[model samples]
Target chain A: MMNQTKFEELCASFALGALDDNEKQELLRELEESRPEQLETLKSYMDTAEHLPAGVEQTDPPEHIRAAIFKEIGAAPATEQQQDEATPPRQIAPPAWIRAAAVFLAAVCLVLLYFTLNLNSERIELAETVEQQRFEILDLRDRVQVAERYLEIIGSRNTYLVSMDGLEPSPSGFGRVFYDPESRAAILQVANLPASPPDKDYQLWVIREGTPVSAGLFSLDVDDQKRYFVLEDFFEEDFEGVDAVAITLEPEGGVPQPTGDMFLLGSPS
Target chain B: MFILFALLKKLTGDAQEEAELLIAVAGKDQQALGRLYDLYKRLLFSLCVSILKDRHEAEELLQEIFVQVWQKAAAYNPEKGTAYTWLVSLTRNRAIDRIRSKSWKNQQITDSDPDNKILELIPTEGSNPLHVTVAKQRSTMIQQFLNKIPDEQRSVLTAAYFEGFSQSEIADQTGLPLGTVKSRMRQGLLKLKEMLSGKEDQI
Candidate 1:
């Protein structure tokens, strides 16, 4: 039973992520009951953490990430075109046939140029130049697409869905983990789990016997279908434990090692 | 004497004008982009290093971020934030994304084999420092402030700031819970902000 000031102090702890689960739940409950002022302050404070590293500014994004974004964009135009077909054509848009004609003309010109320029040359040199130019065009087109899509993905920061296969127990069982490393958070979306008794909850372990750490307690939804569990704690080093990792039915919060019946197992490998 | 004073003011005005000019280049002007690169490369590189923690990765990320600015200049909304703020966010997000990715994480721990040659090829921090306007003295002050935090907090803060972890990631690495990690980071930052603000007063 913490008071308002204590709860506020704990909010600072919550914002810093220093609070344990019980403490965290308590603070969250308090936040729910308390005035909006505390919540606002907490949100602003947390948001600032995102920008506090402002003293350091990246001069640029990696060429690879840019390339990946471009690739995503480049692949999207066809999808966009299909979607656009369902609607009435806009007045400002270029006619599809005209655009197609232009593309055909460009291709013809490219073929002619290819033949004329390579008339006296060996096949290899001519092929290399054309391939290089083709890649360059492809890359440029991809970049244009990324520019269009950037705004849409901007709000969905720091979330990733990674699929993993079961390493043992039910090796066939597959699952996805929605991870946000920025928040040091992950949510397991287990497709299936072995049935366990009421006395035991499925304890999630990061894996590796001595190194295996407790992630948290979890159970499948009423359908015994998908289970969602929050990542409790982990280390970059704990990734070694990732292989052949198994979930087992245990008491709450999970035991240090696998003590009960194996429920689900997964390996990133 | 009056003319000299006015001339100095005008020169200062030109610096602001110069920044605007660079921003425009970043928008659609290639030469302007080159000039902006000339002006800010070193500072940006250092910032990237401070966060990316890997020189090669930072270098690559830096190039990509700039190209993005060039392509997306039309999308740049001046009202939302400064170019500097936008660029910082862009770079940080990419770096953090890389750091947290399973591929990158696996590479970091497993690829213990040192790239001695690559390490040598990469510019040492001070050796080829960018010629940006970030005063060495101010940078030193900031560095000192960084030193004041406990090593554990500093590690997590550095990881979060540069590598782009949410509160949860910090907790994961430090064996703390999501809530605790967020609180620690907020408290840590509040302290640094106060300290830096106080330092400004003293100055």
Candidate 2:
């Protein structure tokens, strides 16, 4: 056991983080068992020493540093709504059993339908119907898997969700982007968007430090105003310095840059 | 003097804001983390740069510190000290860790010497008004307190605190006896404690 005199001798150095590893461990051990009065004295010294760095003038780092940090952390810059939510442990994994059960039930129903249709129809028609049903089941299974993947990404701690609002002339529309930098995955969900002409498409852009890079062009099926687009590899490189996300109306194939008017814009708060 | 008082009042107000940001950070609010980063990045970066003497390394370390803050904000206890104290301690400790690491020693001289590098971390344009005011007040108070100590004693404290020098390191740097360096450091801290506590009582 160290004596009180030796403990007192090390207080200032300890506060400065200048002690060697062994001395630091010893001081911490002593501190854990020290009396209230002794603890208070030590704390006072630490409190004063901590203020020494305030002597340095405040300096602002380069603006890009903030964006770089946000990218590295795999979190979308916080938005006002997110700030209001202030939820702890924002990522919640959905129950795996629930998804598995739904997939199993769908497959069973499709198999039963194939057999029942065969019993009620002409052989040739029944065979065609069964083939179509099989294809539909496969499609449905693929869609479910995609939906589950979306849920997993959104439910992840690493995913950052940014809500985008429609610009002028499209005030009723809104969208959200869920991006996970680590996985290089992103999903774009748009609601109430005005139906686009067959020749035109909605293009998504990931704006990095004010330079907009085309994510891809997307088109809604059958004039539906809502759609969810998923990009398995949203960014070819690790998404760094991304400041904002925007959507613009463009030709069926997206241009190298945003040439048309923007319909939605969002920045990480 | 009037400006100083006004600045001090602003500093007090900003402390309350900082507390709220920390709470939000503890709740895992990324915006709050961003706000906290905006509030202290310069000061932390300046301290890192001063010790490491490499701008690129300092910026990298600054990002690492904030990442730690994002991960470990819950570990901060308000009762122990102010948010500023916690932030300064975290920055200094990380910078010191980098300085003492063997890899850093091998890479040292290729970068500039820390002793001669004047801190140019502060941006002259586009500074936040409240941030500027509070920083000015805190800097003024620390300088005033430091001025009260003897020059040699102050030098020892700076070497140990900012430069992360151990007593023997400070002795070698200053060409003084190791015993003299330790005594001066202890004396300087005691005087600073007295002065700061007296100020707190007045407040």
Tens digit of lDDT per residue, candidate 1, span A66-150? 3343343342222223324522243246889999999999999999999977884767787999999999999877666543333
Q: lDDT of each prediction vs. the true structure?
A: 0.53, 0.72
**Per-model tally of clashing residue pairs:** 30, 1
Write model 1 residue lDDT over B26-83, tens digit each, in one string: 4555444544454445556676677667788777766766666666666545443344
lDDT of 2 by residue, B1-203 (tens): 57657755776677766766777788887777877886787778888887888888988999888888887789776544457766876788788779878443353322243211211111223222233222534666777888889999898888888888877777777799866776777788889877865664232
For model 1 the TM-score comes to: 0.37
How does residue B68 of candidate 1 score in lDDT? Answer: 64
> Which candidate leads the pack in lDDT?
2
- Native-to-model Cα distance after best TM-score fit, residue A93 in candidate 2, in Å: 27
Error of 2 at A174 (Å): 96
TM-score of chain B of 2: 0.67
Cα displacement (Å) at residue A168, model 2: 98
Score residue B94 of candidate 2 by CA lDDT: 80
Q: After superposition, how far is residue A255 of candidate 1 from its true place, in Å?
A: 99
